[model samples]
Target: MTQARRNGVLSDATFDDVRRDAWPVVLLPFGATEPHNTHLPYGTDTILGSEVAARVAAHCMAAGTNVMALPAVPFGVNTTQLDLPFTINVMPSTQLALLRDVIRSLEPHGVRALVLLNAHGGNELRALVRELQPSTPIMLAIVNWWQAADHATFEQAGDHAGELETAAIMHVAPHLVAPDRHTWGDGRSNPSTLEGVRRGVAWMPRRWTQATVDTGVGDPRAATAENGAAFVAQAVERITAFCCELAVADPSSLWAPAP
Candidate 1:
């Protein structure tokens, strides 16, 4: 256990340090490789997920919590965006299989919990977690990092390559963002004709090409690094707190007592 150099990042930790350290909870940042309008890079989700997970893990380690951040899974359910160039889509079944293997690998290492720090909105994983929880000894949990924080700061946090995401990328990796704002796309989506779908009474994946002009669902013109930093900080604080509590929680009695 190299406490002096510990950062709770599994990729950076040495084998000797890992074998000796007590990792009660491990965070797996899951993201997708896809387009984020014309300004942000294709790897925005992956980068954001990895960065947030790393920050949370570092905070946890600093606070003496036994938590580890795993390397992010860079591909996600991009079924609707497959028509777009270079967009990679991993089927739900494949995701389940991959996650199962990850859990199996951790079981022998004495890991007691697994937190899926999901960054991609398309990765519908709640059902997957429910399906796997009963059979696995490792406690399963998921957190959509975007929804982890309040969005009162931004005017409109678009669904995709929009204000919130663009701001976030600007904060984390400014180099990846295109400096020429003129080339940026206005993330306006074409709403469905069906009233049910438009009103959230029904559900269906929007066709990327038909949904928006450039795959963006929100406006990114007002995005600023300052706002992004503030949002990310809030998310990190909330998530770190949750991870810390989960690390020491009794799995058998996770629910609250009779009220």
Candidate 2:
């Protein structure tokens, strides 16, 4: 096998090899272009999503799984955060349309499965998957990388630009992170006025400005590159295992028969 085939990156693979190899499964790393506080770059989610997907794809190939990683989608539903400067929000309908096209394009190439590896909190894609799965021939699955891990190492995993993300960026692309700790936001978030919402029963979108003072939801002062590496390693391992299984799964009968 060639290096690109072994790596299992669609962009890096040559057309000849892609036609010859016919990878059955593809991983689409979906992320958002949004702010991650003052310390982290706007592409934090996309960077992490793409990085994690690439790593997982490489590992899957090593494990003899026919898998490929597509280039990351660097935008997502950011309706609440649109007020924040430079935050791009793609309507859910638009996102679905784009996803539908990608799925349709993969059908003729013998791709049987597509895993949507979502990295951003805002891009809730399960509903979209549910809507698309019945209409398409290919199998669809979504994996939220952050939620896959236990995340017990950090004091606060944070909803937006918090300890987990700060550490992750520090690990993946240290240069993108601001060096001065003094420049980092404390990531303080205000509580919702609704009692049910506070207790997790009711739900409502938070106004970005009103939710947090500095566009952060968790304290990132204590984040370390070491912790981030460990967290990402754990997540990658788990996600890779799942992809390997999915790659080899019989699509017509994915679930086991009952006793």
Candidate 3:
């Protein structure tokens, strides 16, 4: 079994062991099955999400915080990239239903918080969370791992299959990355779309084909394992800190004014 299997991972732990914990925080890694340019694997998002969750869970457990890292949900909202041959897309409504059910299961199990460790850009859950919050008893949070750290940390803040992702996969799963076949992407954007997003005034789903010819948004030629290692370390540290706080937070007063 893998180290991830031994450390309070839900897929690896028995029901008896899981039930013994008073109120563990559950980490659900969410990813998508889509092409990651010519170099990275289709499962890059899933692999990265799962790896981050496992690391955070192991860190929290060793610190005396009960945490369970669930296996990554390999399918996410990939509607934009459906044109890609092997991309698997799940509708936004489908994702919401899946999450609602997942959350329902954890509440009765004494789970305090359900953190969605999201890895794909297309899997936005804030709207679903808003709709579900009033109905559910458990506290839910979403963490876009890439957004947790400062973009200035890397030479380039890539959009997709770029230096940022390439470097991360290199460190997290080096064997799966083929840097030798690196490609270039300028991470282009329609000026109007960029401006609207920056102003928080407009929004629309991007057509992947129109975005880039290679299905990539950033340049990967300069990506290196060292760069990946540093970025992943920073991201893990930030995520682990958030999980630690979630573990001890009281659901009743989670949003109540501090004394």
Candidate 4:
């Protein structure tokens, strides 16, 4: 079952359903199309972003919240990874424009809330939100799904194609994971830039080629599907609670000087 009408999945929902129901908030899944080391699929970020949004949206719908899951934006800002093969890059300006158009589309439909469930580290939507806030009545939120919670469920929560991602893919789509053919990641860092970044004294995009030959940032040796399942379940629980709150929050009082 697509769970279209039940969950308010935009692509799956019919035009009539969308027109009939007043959705309180729409989830915009932002992801990246890039290399996640040599072992993981290129669509790792997309898969994570879309799946998290879908799952949370489903939960909210089951709880009778007016939440809708928009279609996943599969391309993200991958300027640093442009040299890598087939790493589709969308500049920050393009991202802002894309967000503007999406927001514009939602305005006519009476949807005033948008939650950006971002799965890619390279794609940051905060700046876009700051720029577009004054222009619209929409309440925008940018959530980095991977960092939404402390994933202590895993023994090692590797950043890139490390334990965390590998385990996540295992639980979400085990058929796509090939651990047998996987190369272990070490979370290597460039000596020239690593210290500066660690000290917070300088900032620069780390080239994948310069970071590691495999483009991996963490070790996946300790990753397990069981751990992934726990992590994902926790994330869903946390995000669902937030969504439920957003569903009923008064738009006028969202920012009242934080008294």
Stretches of candidate 3 exceeding 4 Å from the true structure: 1-4, 182-201, 256-259
Give the Cα error of residue 158 in candidate 2, in Å: 1.1
lDDT of 2 by residue, 88-117 (tens): 999889989999999999988888889999
lDDT of all predictions, in order shown? Answer: 0.92, 0.89, 0.82, 0.84
lDDT of 4: 0.84
TM-score of 1: 0.96
The CA lDDT at 238 in model 3 is 88
Stretches off by above 4 angstroms in model 1 are: 1-6
- Between candidates 2 and 3, which one is better according to lDDT? 2
User: Candidate 4 has what TM-score?
Assistant: 0.92
lDDT tens readout by residue for model 3, 226-252: 877878888888888888898878878
The top-ranked prediction according to lDDT is 1
Candidate 1, residues 43-111, lDDT tens digits: the string is: 999999999999999888889897899999999999988889999999999999999999999999888
Clashes by residue pair, model 1: none
- Candidates sorted by lDDT, descending order? 1, 2, 4, 3
